[model samples]
Target: MKKLNKNQVYGFIAIAVLSLGVVGCKATSSVEKTEDKTVPEMFAGATKDTLNSGVISWKTYFKDAYLQSLIETALKNNQELNITMQEIEISKSEIKARNGEYLPFVGVGAGASVDKVARFTNIGAMEATTEIKPGKEMPEPLKDFKLGVYANWEIDIWKKLRNGKKAAVNRYLSSVEGKNFMVTNLVAEIANSYYELLALDNQLEIINQNIEIQSNALEIVKIQKDAARVTELAVKKFEAEVFKTKSLQFEVLQKIVETENRINFLVGRYPQHVDRSTGTFNDMVPNVVSAGIPSQLLSNRPDIRQAEFELAASKLDVKSAKARFYPSLGISAGIGYRAFDPGYLFKPESLLYSIAGDLMAPLINRNAIKASYNTANAKQIQAVYKYEQTILNSYIEVANQVSKISNLEKSYSLRTKQVEALTNSVSISNELFRSARADYMEVLLTQRDALESKFDLVDTKMQQLNAMVNIYRALGGGWN
Candidate 1:
């Protein structure tokens, strides 16, 4: 083969460089550049204290031992949490796969083949005339044997492969943050359900007490009817009131069962009795929640952090996709031994080796690359919007909970007073009915009102507890 002269080599190099210049220009389009919105300095109508309750550990924030145990079990056994953990592992594997793409690929192999040529052909005519030895001609059909190691590497001059690996790394981090977000929700759910169970227990107890009170009043009406002081209609009204109050206990009991099963499902266990202390449910006070500053949510909330990581990954994806329009340099090399006879494969004369490099760019039919570039840009924008939305939602949630807690406090206080007044009125109504001054309907109404007020107080306390847990979750607590 004739070798190229210096001028020809230089000319070839110049042409190749020119071709790269023509092909490497990237497809351009407009994309919006956005920055995340700054959160408020403080939550709406909230204190400026920087003591964020979200920083508190779940074990420390939840003082109940039983609740802590349930949360611990769920963290270890919850099905959704376990599934999320596997997703994180899958993301990590993707990072490894992407990382490997930026590095060299190597392999070793062996192969055998047989080839034959017609004597009439030009290369076949030469082969028949040539002699491998003084009297021996080349074989008519040749057997080939080869063993070799080969390597390929793509030079990342444009950082395309590196950017892809970086994107994968960011996605892996996003998956981890997603797991943490799930943990926050799981902890909050179990705590809320636990409180609901306590509230149901208290409501049931109140129903049973009301039933006893109504039954005693019914006995009084029966005695009065026998004494000719009241009609049988009054006696029937008292009995019906007692039966109605008794039925309420069954409704509350069913709710208790369903609630317990919900909690059991979250804890990743079969339905069973949840161990709890119901006697102090009324006395249990909600923990003081700190909203801290709205700005803290960016770092504290897992969903926000997850979205941030996803946004970062999407930006890298755009870079990687954009780089696809640039020239890529690849090198491949092989070293091996080949021989017509298996016994001669290891001989020095049978050795062979080759190396080559190629530089390529998409010169035509680049619609796929353009589509990918546009899709990447769109995703990046989507990620930006998602990040902003998560932050806004988190801030609003905390604000709403802060306002709810304050209103519930006032409502609980008022309801407590109302319950006390109604309890006294029920007793007074009974006294007046015995003296024939008040009607049986008034006594029944007073008893019903007092019972309802007590139930409302329990529900209010449950809501207050739920708000506390919710705010903690909104602030991105519990995962730590």
Candidate 2:
């Protein structure tokens, strides 16, 4: 065998080193440039207080027992949430797979094979001249049997496999955060729908009460018309108002049914009556919400945290991709027994073992690797944008809900006063009409206005409750 001289070996080593350097520089240059955007420390026009509602648990944040029960059920039975949990599991499996890539793969197996060679071939002539025993000739057909354990491993000199494993871990964590975000949304939706159901119930009650009042007014107007005190047109007008209110009653009823079914769907159950408090809807008040500093969203909001994890994973992916442009070292080994006869397979004379290694690098047709590196860099940039977007969205949601809660409170107060004044006018107008101090038209208009004001008050109250629920979710309260 010819051996390489010292100078030739040194020159080869130098060429390899220079090639690696060029590839490393090229890999670095392949990374795309992107703008650096920093997250804001506080929301615009927000107070500096750190007392956020996000720290509160959903159980404590929502005071209603029925709402708490519904949220619990949804968390356990919701299909989308279950699917997210499975994604988390899949990410965990990916971590295991990536980890295995860096570690040695070992396997044990046994096999048998038969081979027949041509008599005129070189191997056949050699076999015909050789003898396994003094008086025995080589077999015409060869039979091989082996039992062995083998191992193969890739040396992560560039930390490629390690970085890939780390990326998988980050993705697993991101999937978990995604599930938490889903929980927050699911809880908020059920709460808002529950409040809406309560509002619809109140409206239905108001309509029923108005129907009775208008029916009595209609009877009064009919008697007055017969006595020649009021015109027939007045009686017809009163009857028409009663009919309109009765129709509204059905509309509100339909809404209640739809809301209840929506709640059932969220809870992952068949359509059924949802349990809720209908009597105290008018007396219900929204919980006080606290908007903390915007920076808290980075830690508290699930979507933001999820995006942060994805960004981390993407950065690791870029590193792994860049490593692909560098040389990879791999080693393989096997130890086994082999023989032409199965009876000799376990003998020490038939034992065989081998070990080998390889160093491989991409020198040509590297467009695929370069594209992968660029794509990874692009995804990293996208993750950064998504993370920042999540933060901005969280802050805006909280800010909007804070403002909505404040405005809803003021509106509720005004609606209460309006309801009180209109309610008084309704009774006063009825007495005046009976006493001939006012016309039937005035009584009819007062009752209709009073009913509408009451309905509006219920709606405002519902908005307040919905805003409270939304702010809690926006603050990332429910998933903990």
Candidate 3:
């Protein structure tokens, strides 16, 4: 390192210290509060510097090809999401328009007019000429036609209009964040629905398999009854059991169709068969999440970021509203040429130019200003609460999904064992009934238990997968 002059070294130290203080102040100011409030708690934890602060691309986060296609379609064609995107564009335009109001506006213009002042009027009485031009007499009343280049601008004396423009920019940024949040939710929703369709498809397949098995059992019972091996009662019981299971198959079929349509609707298309591989739902190892810290939620959640932007915007809005109490300044200017005779219209004496400045402030009866100020204050308060609520809700969702993931894992294991036991019991009961050692009711009950256990197993697995998807969404990972 090269040695610096003593004074230069001190100056560098001073700047370094100033930068440190600025950064420290920013960190403190951004930290609204602190609590490792898990997802179940009422408020959002602080945004951590680490949560999704790593700039990762969203497309890379979700690598599923089918899911990627659905998200792409939704981004392109989903009505509500597209509308929100347009709203973001509109907000940006408002920022531009507000900025223009602070700067000078210039435009071109043209017009033609024949004006005849009434002889009884003051302007007419003061005229030097009492007679009209030889071949170009003035028309009755005033037919005035004029055209010129004009410009107007509001001078930002108190920085009021400039602040308004900045406020508009803040709102525009908030709208963009809002769209980002929508996208996060949209992508997660499509993934969840797609998984659900796969789960339903698996469920239908299971139900069909169970129905076939039950039908075979029914056939066995009919053969034994015909030979007087069991009785007519056992045959009827088996037939009823088969019919009950077959009824369940229809319910699962309906769910599969409905779930597919739901996915199609999200893809922004008509209800139709959804093409998907059920293998993903079964074999897809859900992404392992690092719940780094409770404070990390602020940065990880889109809703929370959105709420922060709205809070900033609301604060700016309040400032803009307060500015209404002060005076406003405006300036306008125009330049052109005009004359009664067309030949003299461009002459130097015919040159017309004017510039003016206006200062306006509310003196009395300022109900509109007062109302605006009051409304701004009300909205500010509302924004504060909404921000708080969004934080709380995001944390809650994360916590629930995290907890659900753990619990569902355990539930699924138990259901798996339950299915095995019930399946064995069915075999044992059927063998005993054949020897007239067990009652018909025992076989029917055993078969029902086995069916229920299998269904429960599938349901538990669905919850596990759904929890993983939801937790990732709550963590704001997908939108990144």
Better of 2 and 3 by lDDT: 2
Runs with alpha carbons beyond 4 Å of true place in candidate 2: 1-14, 17-21, 28-47
Q: How many backbone clashes does candidate 2 have?
A: 0
Q: Local error of candidate 2 at 377, Å? A: 0.9
User: Against the hidden reference, what TM-scores do the models get?
Assistant: 0.96, 0.95, 0.82
TM-score ranking from best candidate downward: 1, 2, 3
Worst 10 residues of 2 by lDDT: 28-37
Query: How well is each residue in 1-480 modelled by candidate 2, as lDDT tens digits?
Result: 899999999999879877765765566464443434355576555667889989899999988899999999999999888988999999999999999999999999899998898889999889889999899987768887889999999999999999999999999999999999999999999999999998998888888889999999899999999999999899889989989999898888888889999999999999999999756788886787778887788788899889888988999999999999988889999999988898888889988898998777887789999889988988988887787777778778988887888788888999999999999999999999999999988998899899989989998999899899998899998998
lDDT of each: 0.92, 0.88, 0.72
Which one wins by lDDT: 1 or 2? 1
Give candidate 3's error at residue 73 in angstroms: 2.5
Instruction: Give the per-residue lDDT digits (tens) of candidate 3, residues 318-356.
Output: 667766666666899999876666666777877899999
Can you give the lDDT of residue 126 in candidate 3?
A: 53
Alpha-carbon runs more than 4 Å astray in model 1: 1-4, 116-126
